[model samples]
Target: MLMYKVTKENGKTVYTPHFPPPLAALDGKTVELQGYMIPITSGFRHNTFMLSVLPIQQCMFCGQNGIPAMVEVILSDSKKEKMSERPVTIKGKTVLNRKERNRLEIWVTDAVIM
Candidate 1:
């Protein structure tokens, strides 16, 4: 439901993710995005995985604009605790500010291993 779509445009890639637009309380702050942890990078992400993102299209590698709202998760702790590659709900503080960036970039904050 919270997935963002990535498409190609004018020889450049376009990354438009639907996220909770900036709010007064969330300004200059970090919030949590809960979804199925995916590894965009192959060798780096395998069994041990988790991905922090505003949407699927918010990839730092392929995204034409450096939207700072996307973050990759490398689950270092017990991978067993992290589950579901499909789609799961997670909550974390918002670390990336769209207004702060001149362009798009991925932004992420570490999740609490509870």
Candidate 2:
């Protein structure tokens, strides 16, 4: 059970999990996550949705590859009828590995296709 706020403000608060927590090991492990869809790179793909791991209020206009360490997951396909501003629950086996001083990115393996 973990949660990261992906909202950004003038003084946005950054989130960090405890030591040796599941935040990094989620890869190859079945886990559930809940957050909003972050379509990066100007939403050109129109099919790719990234999970916002941190609280980011300002939508990124560039440097999509440099998303916050809160964890931005690339989805499998278009599961949502339309992008919802509210948060949603995502369950699947996390995959991929990403780490920084205070950041971690884990891509889920088997998302519910939504």
Candidate 3:
């Protein structure tokens, strides 16, 4: 998990995220995570989607929740399984994006539903 600290810099407040050595070491490594999928497109099959820590109704996007509790997913193949209402496990190479505050915190590529 990522940690954060708030501090004032150059007369401006800044939010800084701290990635522990272990977590930072996961970049580009294959990892498996379980979460609910939030469809990015309107279809039963999708190559890309958002994996949320909670159900879609309770996801960060639904409110002013800090740091999105979601990761962008890109399926390894176009032949992904049909979306399910329940939580699912997925495996893929992890990519951490902390440079931009507006960008996704994590991105999973070459992903497969497990």
- Measured against the true structure, the TM-scores of the candidates, in listed sequence, are 0.35, 0.49, 0.73
Q: Which stretches of candidate 1 lie over 4 Å from their true place?
A: 1-30, 44-83, 97-106
lDDT of 2 by residue, 9-68 (tens): 689765543334655565477777887666654643434466674434644534454555
Which residue pairs collide, candidate 3? Answer: none
What value of lDDT does candidate 3 attain over all alpha carbons?
Answer: 0.84
Across 26-78, the per-residue lDDT of candidate 1 in tens digits comes to 53455555654555445532433435443445545556556434344433343
* lDDT (0 to 1) per candidate: 0.45, 0.54, 0.84
94: Cα error in model 1, Å: 1.7
User: Is 1 or 2 the stronger prediction by TM-score?
Assistant: 2
What are the runs in model 3 whose C-alpha is more than 4 Å off? 4-18, 41-43, 64-68, 100-102
lDDT of 3 at 59: 68
Compute the lDDT for candidate 1: 0.45
Model with the higher lDDT, candidate 1 or 2: 2
